[model samples]
Target: MNTTETARRTAVLQSALAKQGIEALVAYGSGPRESAGMLRYLTGYMPANTEAFLVVPAKGRPVVVSADKNRARAFKTRLGDEMKIVKTTDLTGALKEEVASAAPRGGLVAQAGEFDMTTALHAEFRAILEPYEVTDGYGIVTGQRLKRTAYEAEKHRQATAIADKLVAHAMSIAAIPGVTGPDIMAEVEYLGRRLGADQAGCWLAVGERPAETYFDLFELTEAVGPNARVQIGATVCLDGYYSQVLRIGMFAEPSDRMKEVSERLIAMQDAALARMVPGTPIHEIVDALETMIDAYCPYTRLSDPFRFQSTHAMSNSYSDPGAAPFLNAGRDKSRDAESPLVAEHQVYEVHPNFTLPDVGHVCAGDVAVVGGSGATWMSQYPRGIVRLA
Candidate 1:
């Protein structure tokens, strides 16, 4: 929220606008929206359980449209100036009026469809702005967002550290016998919040693959038994920044085969991490991972229902980012980096997993930041599988 950061964000938007030949950009989002990050990244405001739309022109104070009831809160948070608080029923109508009044006639507007614009809104805008040009602004926003600044890197580091501590506590608890999946899950959530994480994406699976997963549950009674495998992943978000950590636990002592498999998977992951230099192309990193997997376990497929690629980088994408290569499997080869591996100031998470049917899956991972020559592990977590009992 410093002046320099504010100016930097505004400058990013302006650069995108200029490159895209846009005079102004209208970014909008509602109801657990994805575009909220883009809006929040540009402006420090984290919207509550309400919809928000920010109109950033090539100049002047940006206009923020929110529910009438949240007007005071919006100002207090300093989301934006020129606030236009409108009734829920009249939200869309109010937005139309606001944009029409402030934006120049026939000026271009870039809209992010991922979260900002709904199907109905898209139709409505297409009809209303027929005379004016509006384009899918995904490219503009994504291109700008692909690289993280120093400030964002620091936020990720803090969030990742929080996850690291939460995982340590959860792992310690999971070591006890007769502990149910839900029990450990609650502890994980609690620890995440206590460590300054405002939000937590806690994924827990017990006894192979559990059909029902409780994200925010506070209790568990089902006890984990011998050979039972539990996979846990927690994405800790601080303020508006996020970083994720994943781990696997077993209630009984690991079998010889299991230990061997885990060691092999860890080795493969280490090889990939070794290649994560600043100038290394992302595809090459993925390729190295696939090569290791194929050499060790050719029978295992790199998809769900089996051992999915675990060694990949981490970013804010809620879905999956930095998935390892399935180069021979005809998967999409085009990731962010095309050729010539990237390095330096880049952050990635190396998670390599191996799945055995009816037995369970094991995920070993750590966040890494690409330095000038190589990569540094950000989260200090055990790299191999851990037995709880």
Candidate 2:
């Protein structure tokens, strides 16, 4: 991130903090495996083995606290002298001191836990900052992450392009005779890493006939027959942004029944994409998909054992909000389907899958971005079946 972008994001978050009556904000990341989102968002640097925290007050320059001197020196060189980088053995003490320095008045302080806070970390934070109120700032950071910046959108586009390339490569490999599903999966993972992907993972299913079972990489051991149908669902992450591509391929000629089912599934996906415009409620998008499925495949009910989410938010994580918005036959009041609106620059993976009684299971989808007027696709692979010779 450049200086201009950093300034813009800091201003945005500080404004949000002021509005929420928060005097200071402390965003923490415990090593590389946990709570790295907010820390990366603020510093543009991801921690590998050390814990880090970013302190942003209602006013003033932000201070970054690194767990060790080595990491602190590296950040100092990277972020320059404009931003303060402090080395501290006691992370909670450093956080309290920085917050107190920023907000001498001792108003409410928000700590971003990212997902959920563990009891140990929460108790430690509370112990140091006595008399001052501490609240969860996960929403404050994630709310900003939901709307992608131009830089973030470009990163997502690159990630999607990589996913499309991998899908095409997987299709070509799946067409080869005597190749096992696990072999193809290994090649996909290898190529994804060679293409500069930070992390890559996928699910592969191969069967002579359409099988309702969708297996992950570990479960794929059977050799793909000459005329088997293959399904590849791939996800690639580049620079912390993620994109997905799901496709179906056949080694031999697709039968008439396969073509009909593939067409119906593609039509339903297309209808749903058409309605994914800016400002549209998530529930309305689900409704449009449900209607299309009923009009085209009336017998297909949401009660089918193989049904999955129709739409889901995508970002650095595979599932942004984690639990995605789904469409069901009967309105289940228990689902949180309402209130979230698709805003400009938001990316969603529109994956819709259903089981066909005779032909097994059919699935198709790609990543799309919500624009000013409508949604545009990030992945360019064709939606229908890709027949291979």
TM-score of each: 0.82, 0.84
**For all the candidates, what are their Cα RMSDs to the real structure?**
4.0, 3.6
Q: Which candidate tops lDDT?
A: 2
Model 1 scores a TM of 0.82
How does model 2 fare in lDDT? 0.74
Candidate 2 lDDT tens digits, 244-289: 8999998667889888878877777777778777777666666777
lDDT over C-alpha atoms for residue 3 of model 2: 62
lDDT of 1 by residue, 18-131 (tens): 776786677765535666666666665554455666666666556666655565365345633333334345666666776776566687877764345668876776665565
Worst lDDT 10-window in candidate 2: 321-330
- Model 2 deviation from the true structure expressed as Cα RMSD, one decimal place: 3.6
